[model samples]
Structures are given as C-alpha cells and as structure tokens.
Target: MPAIVGAVKVINVSASSIFHIGDVYAMAPKSSAKTYAGGGSFNTGSGIHIQLSDSHTYVNDNDKFDQTIIGT
Candidate 1:
C-alpha cells in the first residue's frame, strides 16, 4: 500500500438539528479555500463534515440538504 502523510483539515456544517448517518448534504466550499460551492455527498448527518490534510485560512459556510430535500 502507498504511504500517506501530512496535516489534517476538516469542514463542518450544521443544520441546527440532529440527523443520522449515510445522510447526504450539498455543501459549498469554505469561504477560505478556493473550492467551489457544488453538490457533494457526505456520510454523516445534521450538517456537512469534511476532513482535509491542513488548516484553512478563510471563513466558510455551506447550504446543506438531504436526498429527500434535494431529491434522489
């Protein structure tokens, strides 16, 4: 197997509530990273949670959704 190394980063969005696992969310890129605000899938719930390899330097907020809300 290949070796992995370096820092760890994460992005999280909350729906101001609780949810279950295997839920999906539509997240926008953190205001800091140049990543675009597109539709992506997540395994967690309530909000969106993403993990990266390093720290960030910008403000971020995302619009979250589920398969039912956005449609499947």
Candidate 2:
C-alpha cells in the first residue's frame, strides 16, 4: 500500500511529553539542507529525544517541527 502523509502542523507537546516510537515529524530546511522528514523518537536523556530519520543531524531549535505521521 502507498504511504499516507498526515496533516502538516507545528508539533505541540505537553511540558513533559515526549514523542513515541514510530512517530513522524517534519523539519524545515536549514543552512544548506532541504526540508527533512523525521520520525521514531528515542529518548537519550534530560527530556531530550532524537528522530530515527536521516535528517536527525539537521534538527535544531530553529527548525520547525510539524506533523506526526504514523505507521511505516
């Protein structure tokens, strides 16, 4: 089956909430990188988590976090 893209919107999590595994997020382009597709949240420590996609390295405070596409 074809993948379905979810609604695009900025991510708004509770103060202590964290994204779960298989959650997808979108990040705007930064520096020399283009728009990125990220997903799969993994908690590292101190309320910080990383996406499982290739754009993980480009994520930053300035980047926009939009959408939460579920499923593979």
Per-candidate TM-scores read 0.15, 0.16
Model 2 ranges with Cα > 4 A deviation? 1-3, 20-72
Q: Whole-model lDDT for model 2 versus the true structure?
A: 0.48
Sequence-dependent TM-score of model 1 = 0.15
Model 1 error, position 10 (Å): 0.4
- Cα lDDT tens digits for candidate 2, 3-47: 566665656965434544343476333222246454554435686
Report the Cα lDDT for candidate 1.
0.43
lDDT of 1 by residue, 1-72 (tens): 444545644466455333333434653322222333333433557777776656445545564522233221
Point to the candidate with the largest lDDT: 2
The CA lDDT of each predicted structure is: 0.43, 0.48
The top-ranked prediction according to TM-score is 2
Off by over 4 Å in 1: 13-72
Candidate 2 — worst ten consecutive residues by lDDT sum?
A: 27-36
